[model samples]
Target: MKLSSEQIKQKLKDAGLRVTPQRHAILEAVYTLGNHPSAEQVIDFIRVRYPGIATGTVYNVLDVMVESGLVKRVKTDKDAMRYDAIMNRHHHIYCAESDRIEDYFDEELDELLQAYFRKKKLQDFKIEDIILQIKGNFNDNSE
Candidate 1:
């Protein structure tokens, strides 16, 4: 999902964020990387293009973008916070060995979860989001 610079500007504008070069570079780095990356990784990427950008600026930009619903922050089992560019509904598969995260989606699983929760009928509790982190080892030979 490669977004053009114009599209990135539109996204920032829509989120009520000032579209600056640093913000654009940070967003592009996250989107292009696809995989959930930590703030440090984002900073490293931005440094290549915008040499003067500070690490703290990247962190601030990510926080603002997430607060504005432009990006999502994912917490892995190991307790590392990773930022995701995709904001849609989906689950994740975390590889224990490599500490890698992969997106997972299934209509059947979604429906099952919804139905199960509806039947349970917890009192006064609302489910804001459902993100399943299936921990497993990577099967390199299978592929």
Candidate 2:
């Protein structure tokens, strides 16, 4: 799911956001990191290449990305905010021990959830998307 610079730039344009070096770098960092990264982690990663990058700038770019649906914030039980680049409908496997997050995609699970919600038809609510963050640890033999 790695995206090229051109793809990232196109994404920005598609989101009605101006393409800038900072924005590109921030988006690239998020995608490149793959693992959900926090603002401090992103800042550290960016600093390795662009030492002049400021914390505020990274936070601002992240806000824009979140607003434009390019990235989503994932909060851990400890309330730490992490940014994820993937926007597709899916769930998460959160390792509480390590604070690690992994994307989980199951078409059947999605169908089942949708069917259950549709059947319930909760009062006057409508369904948009379902995000399940399953928390647990994974052994080396587990997958």
In order, what is each prediction's RMSD in angstroms? 2.1, 2.2
Candidate 2 segments whose C-alpha is farther than 4 A from its true place: 141-143
Candidate 2 lDDT by residue in tens digits, 20-118: 989998999999998999988888888898899888999999999999999998888767689999988888999877777899988999999999997
Q: In terms of lDDT, which candidate is strongest?
A: 2
Candidate 1: C-alpha lDDT:
0.87
Q: For model 2, give the 10-residue run with minimal summed lDDT.
A: 134-143
Off by over 4 Å in 1: 141-143
Predicted structure 1: clash tally: 0
Q: Write the per-residue lDDT of candidate 1 for residues 38-128, one digit (tens) a residue.
A: 9888888778877899878888999999999999998876665799988878899888667788988887898899999989977998988
